[model samples]
Each structure stands twice: as structure tokens, then as C-alpha cells.
Target: MEQGLLVVLNGLVYGLLLFMLSSGLTLIVGMMGVLNLAHASFYMLGAYLAYSISTVVGFWPALVLAPLAVGVIGALVERYGLRPVHRHGHVAELLFTFGLAFVIGEIVPLIWGRLPVPYRVPAVLDVPLFALAGTAYPAYRLFMMLISLAMFCALFAALAKTRLGLVVRAALTHPDMVAMLGHDVPRVFTLVFGAGCALAGLAGVIAGNAFTTEPGMARSLGAIVFAVVVMGGLGSLSGALVASLLIGLVQTVSIGLDLPFYKALSALGITVDVGGRLHDLWLLSVNRAAPVVPYLLLVLVLATRPRGLLGSRSA
Candidate 1:
């Protein structure tokens, strides 16, 4: 029971991190209809930046500056690179972001080298916050959870309460009407894109030490983020949150359970014949199959409710 509770708590922390990374991607898609293939590259950039900045100015300053720097870069990319490709349609935009991701991947090695950087949690937050069972939980992980929850609340308030958010939402369904009312639709797109990137950057800042700051980290995590978005629905922020948490829990819990399939079934008194036909099934362990859970959930979600859990049918 203690182990189960511990895994659930850890899963919640990891899920919030995924939501932080994915929220921006979903926001851009929901408001601007742009699918950014390079979104995770920005996340990698944030991690690297946090590592470097923290080395000099300390973690607190890095937490503020890294995301701001990433946001500015995002805005510049939108204004210069993506805006020009907008005339060619969604395919062109996707290809542009894909190419950008490749460039970032290649360039990361040149800047940070091929090794993982030493990005540690700050001293103040390095201690154990509490204990579950006999295991101590890191203060940093608790901080991460609280910060992410705050971010989610702030984002929700911005979108639901603020004037700028209203304009962005309005532009989504009625771009022409927004333009007629003298709102700058193009500028709104750029801001939304930048804000999304900022959110991803913030995730990187907090998650760098936990996940490690390395060039290949983007490639490792990129697909899972996409899966979260897809399983949540293309343009749904709330759905992304739900999917992120679900996938995070599935992954964490699976990684913790090392029992073989046969044993797992037999625990419930279901005996499988492992002598011949079902031998392979008996050999399968949860740890070995952990990485595939998210993809499997994606397939199952897509098969049953094509629009996702909280997504609209039209989405």
C-alpha cells in the first residue's frame, strides 16, 4: 500500500511536468492552428539554458531568465521564420518546424557538447521534504508540483479572464471578425506561440535536473509529448492536461512494477499455460513493457473516442 501511494504521488509530479511541456503546444494548435514539430527542441534549449545560467547566477534567476529568453526566441521565430511560411499552408508550417528541430538538434552538440550537463537542484531545495513509506521525497519534486499547479491556474485565469486571452479565443473562431474590429490577428498568433514556448521553457527549467540536461533528451521526450497532445485532442488545453496526467501515471506505475505477466495473472488465480503457446506471455515483464504504455493508451483512446476525453467532436 505504501509503495502504491508513493508511485501515485510521483506519477502526479511527473504528470504535472508533462502538462507544463504540452500546454504550450496545445495552445498554439488551439488558437493558431499551427502544429509545431520543433516544440520539444525549445524545451531542450530551456534545459541547457537553465543549466548554464544556474551555474553563474543561481537557480532562482535561471528560473526567471531561461523562460523569458526562450519566449523571446519563440516570438522571433514566429515573426521571421514561421510567418513567411504561413502563406503555403499547414504542410509548409509543419515542415518548417521539423527542419528547425533538426537544426536545433545538430546545433545543441556544438554548443553544449555531446555530454549531459551537471544540472543539479538548488541547495535550498535539495533536501527531503517528507517521507512516504521508508522513502524520502525530494523537496525539489514538491516544489515542481506546486509551481506547475500555479502555472496551470495562472494559464487558466489568463485564458478565461483576461482581455488578451479573450481576443486570442475570439480570433480562433472568427479571425475575420477580429480583424474587422481592428485586432492584429498576426500579432496575436506570434504572442500565443511565444507564450506556449515560454510554458515549455518553464517546464525545462524545473525538470532539467530531474530528467538531466542533454542534447538527445529532446528526441527522447518529443514523441511522448506529441502522444499526450494527440490523445488529448489537437486543440484542447484541458484535454492535454488530462492526457498528460493519465500517461504520466501509466508510465510511472508501469516502471515500478517488475512482475511478469504470468505472475501478475496468477496472483489473481488465473493460471496460464506457459509450457508451449503462452511461454512468451509469461516472460513479459512490466518494466520491459513500460515505455509502450503511452502509445498503447493513445491507440486505445483514438479507437474508442476519436475526439479524445474532453475534446469536442469537431476538434
Candidate 2:
């Protein structure tokens, strides 16, 4: 029971982390129709920025400064890099962002070197929060959960209940109408893009210490972020949340299980003959296959429901 609970909690932690990263992309794609392939680069930048800032000022300050810096960079990228290509349509925009992602990927290794940095959890949050089912849960994980939940609430309230949210949403479907109403529609786009990048940055800041902070971190997470966005629906925040939690739980549960492929199949009344070449494949344990679970889920979702769980429009 305790182990099961631990797995669930771990899954939630991971799911929320994914949400933090993907929510920004959802907003940008949904609102501006710009894919921003370099989105995960912003996440990597945040982690590196936080690492640098924390080394000088401390983690608390880095937590605020790093994301803000990333937001500013994102805004600049939109204003200068993406705006010119916008006139050429989405293919141009996609190509530009893809190249931009590549550039950022190369630059990071140059700046930070091709190695993982020592971005450890702050000492204050390194202790256990409480015992669950006789297992100790780290306080930092709880902190991460709280931050993610708070971000969701604040983001939801801002979009649904505030004037800016109204304007942003209006700009999405009716940019001309919004512009005619005395709003700078282009400026709105810039802000939205920046805000989205900032969210990705914030995810890096929090997750860097929790996980690993290295050059390849963005590449590792980039695919999963897109998967979550697609599975949750392209621009649906609520869908993203649901999809994030679902993927998180699935991956965690898979890792926690120790059953081998052949045995698992046998328990389901399916039998497969194990041969010399495929014996190792049949003997693969669930824990060893956990990393593949999200992609499999993505494939299933795309095959069955291409529009995603809560997405209104088909991709």
C-alpha cells in the first residue's frame, strides 16, 4: 500500500512538472498559432540561469529572476525573430523556431559545457515532509506540488476572471476586432509568447534541482511536452492538466511494477513463445520500460482521438 501511494505521489509530481512546462506552449500555440519549437530551450535556459543566479544570490531569488529573464528573452525572440517570419505563414515560423532551437542547443553547451551542473535542492527543503504509508515523502516534492498547483490556480483565474484574460482570449480569435478596439494586437502576441516562455523557464527553475540540469535536458523533455499538449488537446488548459496527471501516473506506476513482459502477458491470458533472439525482449521488466510509456500513450491518443481529450479543434 505504501509503495503504491509513493508511486502515485511521484507520478503527480512528474505530471505537474509537465503541466508547468506544457501550459506555456499551449497558450502560445492556442493563442498565436505559433508552434515555438524553441520552447524547451527556454526551459533549459531557465535552469542554467537559475543555477548561475543561485550560485551568487541564492535559490529563492533565482526562482524569481531566472523565469523573468527567460520571459524577456522569449519576448525579444517573438518581436524580432518570429515577427518577420509571421508574414510568410506557419511553415516559415516553424522553420525559424526549429533553427532557433538548434542554435540555443549549441550555445548552451558552449556556455555551460557538456556536463550536468551541481544544482541540488536547497537545504531548507531537503528534509522529509511527512510519512505516508510508512514511507517518508520529501518536503521539496511537496513544495514543487504546491508551486505547480498555485501556478495553475493563478493562471486559470487570470484567464477566466480577469480583463487581461478576456483581452488575450479575444485576440486569439479576433485579432482585428481587438486591434480595432484600441488594443495593440501584435503587442499582445509578444506578451503572450513571452509569458509562455516564462512558464517553461519556471518549470526548469523548479525541476533543475529536482532532476538533472544538463545541456540535453531540453531535448529529453521536449518530446514529452509536445505529447502532453497533443494528448490534452492543443490549446486546452484543462485538457493539458488532465493529460499531465494521466501520463505522470502511468509512467510512475510502470516504473514501480517489477513484472516482466512475458509474465505480464501471461497474466492477461496472452501467450508468446520466447526465442533466443527475443528472449531478452520478452524478459524486459516493467520498470525498465517505464520511459516508453508516455510515447505509447501519445500514439494511442493520436490514433483514437486525434483532437485530444478536451481539445475542440483537430490537429
Candidate 3:
């Protein structure tokens, strides 16, 4: 029971972190219909920038400023880089962002070098928040859960209640109607793009130290973020949330389970020989397969429900 509780807690933490990274990407794709392949690059920039800013101004200020800076940069990219490519086609736009991702990936190492930067959690929040099942959970992790929940609430409220959210929702579903309604759709696009990037940056600010702050961080996380978006659905915010938590829980729990197929089957009174067809399968362990779990879930989701968990559009 204690171990089960620990797994649940860890899963919730990880799921929230995944949501932080994925919410922005889903918003951009849902509203703008652009994949924004470089979104994770923005996350990488956020971590590096936050580290630099935090060293000079402290963590509190860095939390506020780094995301704002990234938002401005995202705005510029949407204005100058993506707008021109929009005329060509989505394929061109995708290629543009893909190339930009490569460029940023190359540039990061040059600026920060290959080593991981020391982006530690603040000492004030370093103490244990509480004990659970003989384990002391860090205050920072609890703080992360609270912040992520707040973000989720803020985003939902904004989209559901505010005039701006109404506009964004209408534009996403009916761009032509929104344009005809005398709204500046291009400006809306820019703001949404920037806001999406800001969310990614905010995720980095909180998650950098918890994970790691290094040049290769984006590359490591980029695929998982994309998987979350895809599994959630191409343009569904709620779907993203559901998928993030589900994937996070599955990954965490799978990693923690040390059960080998052989032992599992033995409980059912099924025994296998060393050279039997089931031999390799029986030897496999969850720990060894943990890294592939997300992708595996992705494949299963795609195969079963191409539109994603809560996706409205049909594939």
C-alpha cells in the first residue's frame, strides 16, 4: 500500500509537469494550426535564460521574467518567421520550424556548453513538505503541483469565461467567420503564439532543476512532448490534459514495477522453458521497457482512436 501510494504521488507530479510542457503546444496547434516543432526549443531557452537570470536576480524574479522574455521572442518569430511561410503552406511552415529547431539545438551547446548547469531549487523551498509512507516529499514538488493546478485552472477559466477566450475559441473553429467579425485575426494569432510559448517557458522555469538544465535537454524531452500532444489529440486542450496525466501515470508506475513476465506468468501456473518461444517475453521486465511505454501508448492510441481521447476532429 505504501509503494502504491508513492507511485500515485509521483505519477501526479510527473503528469502535471507533462501538462506544463504540452498545454502550450496544444494551444498553438488548436488555434493556429501550426505544429510549432521548435516549441521545445523555447522550453530549453527558458531553462537556460532562467538560470542566467536567477543567478543575478534570484529565483523569484527569474520565474516572472524569463517566461515574459520568451513570449516576446515567440511573438517575433510568429511575426517575422512564421507569417511569411504561412503564404506558402503548412508544410513550408512545418519545415521552417523544424529547421529552426535544428538551428537552436546547435546554438544551445555553443552558449551553455555541453555540461549541465547548476539550476538548483531555492534553499527556502528545499525542506521536506511532509512525510508519506516513510518517505519525505520535497516542498518543491508539492509547490510544483500547486502551481501547475493553478495554471490549469487559469487557462480553463480564461478560455471558458473571458471575451478574449471566446474570440480565440471562435477563431479556432471558424477562422473565416472570426475574420469577418471585424477582429484582427493576425494579431490574435500572434498573441496566442506568444502565450503558448510563454507557457512552455514557465514549464521550463519550474521543471529545469527538477529534471536537468543542459543543452541536450530539449532533444531529450522533445519527442515526449510531441507524443503527449499527439496522444491527447492534435488540437484538443482537454485531451492534452487527460493524455498527459495518463501517460505520466503509466510511465511512472511502469518504471516502478519490477515484475518480470516469467514471475507474473508463474502466478497463473504457467511455466516456460529456457529456449521456449515465451522465454524472451518472460524475461522482459517493466524497468527495461519503461522508456518505450509512452511511444507504445501512442501507437495503441493511434491504432484504436486516431482522433485522440477527447479530440473532436476525425483523422
List clash counts for every candidate, in order: 0, 0, 0
Q: How do the residues 1-315 of candidate 2 rate in per-residue lDDT, one tens digit apiece?
A: 777888989999999999999999999999888777899999999999999999999999999999999999999999999999999999999999999999999999999899999998999999998998888899999999999999999999999999999999998778999999999999999999999999999999999999999999999999999999999998899999999999999999988779988888898899988776789989999889999999899889989998998998897
User: Against the true structure, what is each candidate's TM-score?
Assistant: 0.94, 0.92, 0.94
TM-score of 1: 0.94
Cα lDDT of candidate 2 equals 0.93
- Using lDDT as the measure, name the better of candidate 1 and candidate 2: 2
Which 10 successive residues of model 1 have the least lDDT summed?
306-315
RMSD values for the candidates in order, in angstroms, are 2.1, 2.5, 2.2
Candidate 3 per-residue lDDT over residues 82-182, each given as its tens digit: 99899999899999999999998888889988899999999998899888788988999988898899999999999999999999999998988999999
What C-alpha lDDT values do all the predictions have? 0.90, 0.93, 0.90
Strongest candidate by TM-score: 3
TM-score result, candidate 2: 0.92
After aligning candidate 1 to the native by TM-score, how far in Å is the CA of 283 from where it should be?
A: 4.8
Give the range of the ten consecutive residues with the poorest summed lDDT in model 2.
272-281
